[model samples]
Target: MAKIWAKAPSPCIGVCKFRDEGRCLGCQMTKPEKKRFKRLKGKAERRPFFLMLRERLEARDRWNYWSRMYRRRCLKKGADCPLDKLEGAEREARAA
Candidate 1:
């Protein structure tokens, strides 16, 4: 079975005491929509959850284009992304 946080109850404190710069420590979600981010960590499977995280963060980036939007998709899953496709996701935001 999955962990309790994965179950997605009232996990986030919403006070956002854990925000580093514009990201929340709970899910490392950005400031614009940290509240919108899932309180639970993402699932292991590659599906809508991952896509949603990508979309949400990308949306936030679009809203704040003047700021530095470093592509860091791997951080979402603790993996490595040398190509930084997630970094260039600004294009995705534009299309949206």
Candidate 2:
């Protein structure tokens, strides 16, 4: 089940350089993925996109830096971060 949000913020952290092949060094989203995110309307779509983006960041070992910046962005936008909830759930799953 995807976590619903009143408003999900973009995963981009303004570091738009495509330094890692086609992925952004900041959010690990490609240009098309970024555009796709902007086109998504509801929480169902956005949340999954965020999760996928997080996975991409993790694959690149960039989640640490990107998560911090993304959390700040969510704070500034008054939006709930998908990473927070997802990470907590992951920890609980591991514990049990």
Candidate 3:
């Protein structure tokens, strides 16, 4: 039997229009990043990708929208939201 994934799925929130220098305004992921995300098979592999995406979103001041959207997506999918694990000041800082 395959291991069940407790983690969130792809960061994509169904908004695929690429903008901001090839980055998707929805998830801040580029086309290649989206493809790479698909090939990641486990939590270990996917966590780094999410962290990277978070950084990118922060850089673009997009975390407010993307984080809220992603949290909703994770809830709807019944998957564990990675953002829920954010710690202390890091979490608070990002919430800005």
Which ranges of candidate 1 are over 4 A from the true structure?
1-44, 62-96
- Candidate 2 Cα misplacement greater than 4 A, ranges: 1-6
Which is the leading candidate under TM-score? 2
Mind giving the per-residue lDDT tens digits that candidate 2 earns over 1-96? 343443667789999999898888888888999888878877667767777877888898998998899889988987777777778878999999
State in Å the error of residue 41, model 2. Answer: 3.6
Better of 1 and 2 by lDDT: 2
lDDT (CA) for every model shown? Answer: 0.40, 0.80, 0.77
Candidate 3, 36-75: lDDT as tens digits? 8878876567667777888898898989898899889988
Separately for all candidates shown, the number of backbone clashes (residues 3 or more apart, or on different chains) is 1, 0, 0
For model 2, state the Cα shift of residue 62 in Å. 0.6
Q: Report the C-alpha lDDT of model 1 over 8-86, residue by residue, as the tens digit.
A: 3222223345456666544445665544444435334322343555565455553232112222323444543322333
Q: Of 2 and 3, which scores higher on TM-score?
A: 2
Using Cα atoms with residue i matched to residue i, what is each candidate's TM-score against the true structure? Answer: 0.26, 0.82, 0.78
lDDT, candidate 1, equals 0.40
